[model samples]
Target chain A: AQSVTQLDSQVPVFEEAPVELRCNYSSSVSVYLFWYVQYPNQGLQLLLKYLSGSTLVESINGFEAEFNKSQTSFHLRKPSVHISDTAEYFCAVTLYNQGGKLIFGQGTELSVKP
Target chain B: DVKVTQSSRYLVKRTGEKVFLECVQDMDHENMFWYRQDPGLGLRLIYFSYDVKMKEKGDIPEGYSVSREKKERFSLILESASTNQTSMYLCASSLTGTLNTEAFFGQGTRLTVV
Candidate 1:
């Protein structure tokens, strides 16, 4: 079994400011990490994922997340946020042997203010 | 691109009524999932199916049941709708195999139980 924990429940940042959303997971076996963004009244969209190879993964919209195995963390980051970036972000983990059943965190609401 | 479609965008139901939420995937993915999203809680998995006629309980499956009769369609059932079950429901599908697989989500169905 795998569990994901997103530390921040809300993150308020000004436009053009860099922000980081912390996430940690606990699992005895190998797992896959993912970040998803949900806009108001919509479902979630994949932002990035960390499976193998590089520990760092990036999205096309300037969002990135680093998978730290030692710390059991996969934190999402963005260099500069825009007003449109305001949304709820979720951190998830899937166990290797569970046939890809995802467990998500409580979510962090990112409010990018103008 | 993978597309997951939910049956409704918004639904209003009364308590004790039976409710069914439908989901269909166009990608022919082998795995389908049903999850509920709440305000404080990000997303909690209710049920999942890896193949037709195969279903598994997820983290929060007590109040929900699922059916996967065909390959492309999955349904989530609430035997007796309750006020607590009023939340956003999301359906997702993914390919089966590795832990790194990404799941595509639908636009979500907001169910309001009164």
Candidate 2:
């Protein structure tokens, strides 16, 4: 079985400040990792994903996450955040053979204050 | 762009009532998933369908059932609604055979059990 753990329940940062959300996973087999962002009253949107290429993956919105196999971590980072970036982020993992069932973390609420 | 649509944005139902939530994706993806999102728990998978008439249980599948009679439609059914089952329901779809492919989600349906 695979599970994901998001270390931070909430992270508050001022506008233009950098932010990082920690995520760790436990999987016995090789897995695929993903980051998703959910705004208020909306569903989740894909942020980035790490499949089999370089360890680091980036999203178009200036967000990046690196897949560290040794540490079993895929932490998300943004150089700067805006008030509009305030949302909930979730990290998910699925086994390489699993069809499409993703195990998600507890989520980290990012509040970007103006 | 892929589009996933949920039946409702907000729903109010009494305890013990039968509830059904519908989802439709226009991308013709072979995989569809149902998940429930809570405040702190993030998104927990309830069930998923790989193809029409083929359903599989996910992490949390108690008290919930799903039906996929058509290729583009998936429905989540609550045999008997309970207070604990009240949460934001999300539907997502993705192409088959690609573990790294992104899943597109609907706007979500928020259900409140009274």
Candidate 3:
């Protein structure tokens, strides 16, 4: 069975500080990776995804994740986070032909203090 | 953008009461999911429907049931609400075939079982 693991349960960082949310997955076959974010008083949204082709995937809000096949990791990173970036991040994976069922990690809460 | 809407943002129910959480997606997505979000558990899927009248059990579906009479709507039912079932319930929708398609989520419903 496939599973996801997020390294940090909570990360407190100052504004403009760089942040990294580590994620690791266990799967024998190829899979799609995703990062979803839930801001305060808001719904969850897709931050980025890794399907194929490139090893790196980026979201519009300056967040990027690199797919490391050998390490089975897809960690999300932001060079300079803002106060508005405080949110809960979830790492998820779906099998290639599994019809879009996602297996999620334990989540990481990122708190950016101003 | 896809819009996934849940029936309630907050609900309080007594123990042994029957509870229902409703979800609707405007994008006519083929897949709709119900997930329960806890502090350290991220989001655990309770049930998912791929098409009308088709439902599948997810990771934590033991205490829940689902209904999908139409393509855009999915409902999660708790036969008997309990204190342990109090959590944030989230609904999500997505397309089926495309491997890179992302799931869009609704603002969660915070259910409190008293």
lDDT of 3 at A76: 99
Candidate lDDT values, in order: 0.92, 0.92, 0.92
Task: Please list the residue runs of candidate 2 whose C-alpha ends up more than 4 Å from where it truly belongs after superposition.
Answer: A97-99
Q: lDDT tens digits, residues B53-114, model 3?
A: 99989989988999999898999999999999999999998888856578889998999999
TM-score per candidate: 0.97, 0.97, 0.97
Model 2 alpha-carbon miss at residue A20, Å: 0.8
Deviation from truth (RMSD, Å), model 2: 1.1
Which residue pairs show backbone clashes in model 3? none
Q: Which residue pairs show collisions in model 1? A: none
Clashing pairs in 2: none
| Span of ten consecutive residues with least summed lDDT in model 2 chain A | A93-102
Candidate 2 residue A76 C-alpha distance from true site, Å = 0.5
Model 3: residues >4 Å from true position, as ranges?
none
Could you give candidate 1's per-residue lDDT for residues B1-114 as a string of tens digits?
888999999999999999999999998889999999998888998999999999999879988999999999999999999999999999999888744588899999999999
Fnat across every predicted model, in order: 0.59, 0.63, 0.51
